[model samples]
Target: MSNSNYVLVLFYSRHGSIAEMAKFIARGVNKVTKMDVKIRQVPDVSDTTTIASPAVPDEGAPYCTLEELANCSALAMGSPSYFGSMAAPLKHFIDQTSTLWLTGRLIDKPACGFTSASTMHGGQEQCLHSMMTPLLHHGMVWVGLPYKNKALISTTSGGTPYGASHLANSTNDTTLTEDEKALCEAQGQRIAEMALKLQ
Candidate 1:
């Protein structure tokens, strides 16, 4: 049951910003020798309460399997902000993980979170924290951007000491700065390193 080569970068992207961040994080995971990255996405929730998203997503990362979560060496989660919290679909997806919680499947694993918002102050931090709650219940060791990441002190776009984030705009801009990308990679590398050592 021991995995020495993988980390799961799981996320939900409504308008594509958060998905982009997840890729950057995965790229960082690939920077380490013998490390592997699995990108997983959650299915979109339907507006009709009685209906459900298809079992498979049409594009982007495949829907996450609970087994993937249980077996991954570490987790990097993301979501777009929905008024100071993660979007409903991502939250709903995480809510379905009770089996993992009961078995402590993710216990002691290194975890980090990321988010994107429509404005500069559109509750990015709150969304990151909201996403972390479930991981906390699973006994994850939380990781955040450290001062040593370089981007923490010089970023103008979407880097944060709390976690990596992107400023998706009210004007519909979705570009990530170099700093944001660097921070995302740094977070990934940091968690991957911790997971490998802890194992």
Candidate 2:
């Protein structure tokens, strides 16, 4: 078990692709010393108001709670893009976090974001930007990989300074490129470093 403080890596992955991205980000978070990463995911959402998901996820990362968001030293939020924005499930989850905002539990913490999409131009950057909104509202510091990360310069598949991403093959679950993986690690390390400095 990790005894040191943690950077919570929270995400919602519908097609498994986003989940892979989350793992790569966590890999980056693991690179830091005396600080660990906790991977948590949200449960699925349904359009029918009467239909509800279970409290525990059947697979992938465990479902995240408001306390998870409130307690983490930092965060790396992810989601697959949907119409130039974050997916509804993640949006729904964030909508319920106003209490955290009110208490300013996230203030001054470093935060970052990531995303995946079926197509090369499927608004991945927009999705990343969309996830950044609530973090900004909470007064959390935003982080992204710098150009100094070699992958940012050579990646034709997926990877960006805005965070990290995967171009995503047709199935939308293609394995992340080496570049994408490196950038995810870079973002994690960056957030962890800042979180440590803030301590």
Candidate 3:
């Protein structure tokens, strides 16, 4: 298992905070020797008549494919909180994984979650939980941060043992604090390590 093995950092972002957090996590994944990361994103679903997004996004990571999701050694999912849950586009994409579930393609793989929310108390934990549910159902091992990270104990803003979290503020202008950045990197390292051992 070398850099040939990759962790899929999949996410959906509305205001860019979650996407920004994905970068630190990817940096952490890259810290481990023989490991690499692929960051992917889902498209916004349409409620109007059927319309497809561009083949490639205008910017950021390319859209995630089911093949990529099924084949990755590990997964790190991110989403912005939507009323205490994951945003609907990410959920809609996850719902399409029944075929992978039927074949057990993702079973026993390592998985972790990250989230961004509007306030300190704005359901980041719940958002993490919501992201975890599908991974659990897929039989993927859930990876979480540990309190030993120190930031978990001292953070005034977002940093959680549940995963990595960020407080984006009302205007969505808040940047990730140093504590949150460290935890994101730690989480990426942890998942890459687990994926290596599992391999």
Candidate 4:
């Protein structure tokens, strides 16, 4: 695929909710003509020094590479909430992108964030903000869900003006509410449209 035409849906999911959200976001991106979506995930971080993650994941999306990241026309990133911040694994992957930052490869590319939390007050917005910081530092334009998206105002589970979000409940349910899905799609579509205009 041509690097210039695709949006990278990069994420890290612990209980799979974030991954499911990535799919809906990709579906929204697919609605736009002449644009494509690439879903990729980062490997889990291990605490043991001797442990090493496999080059390819045993299941789910393949690991993302720096090249794929630098070449995307836009980016949609997600991660499960970890203490009011992004999970360590996604942050680990992003920390390695100093190469892209130094060269301004992602400069002006449209980007958005998505996240999931186990409860209504589980720091979903803070996690989204954490994810957006590195993107902003890379000179990428940040895109956010607007109140115009009816779901953002109506959602009880997880929609936010900051970005798409999901309330996973304490049981860690991965199923997205209708409103959550709608906001995710809107976020995706908005980023894709913005990417095209910037191109």
Compose the digit string of candidate 3's lDDT tens values, residues 114-159: 9998888999999999999999999999999999999889988888
In the range 119-167, model 2's lDDT, one tens digit per residue, is 8899999988998888899999989888998889999988877888888
Error of 4 at 119 (Å): 1.0
Candidate 1: tens digits of C-alpha lDDT, residues 43-79: 8778753227787887888899889899999999999
Q: What are the models' TM-scores? A: 0.93, 0.95, 0.95, 0.95
**Candidate 3, lDDT over the whole model:** 0.91
Any idea what lDDT model 1 has? 0.86
Per-model lDDT: 0.86, 0.85, 0.91, 0.92
Off by over 4 Å in 3: 1-3, 48-52
Q: Candidate 3, after superposition: displacement of residue 135 in Å? A: 0.7
lDDT of 4 by residue, 1-199 (tens): 4445999999999898999999999989988988999999998887743225798998999999999999999999999999999988899899999999999999999999999999899999999999999999999999999899998888889988889999997546999999999989999999999999998
**Any idea how many clashes model 3 has?**
1
User: How many clashes does the backbone of model 1 have?
Assistant: 0
Backbone clash count for every predicted candidate, in the order shown: 0, 0, 1, 0
Stretches of candidate 1 above 4 Å error? 1-4, 47-51
Off by more than 4 A, model 4: 1-3, 48-51
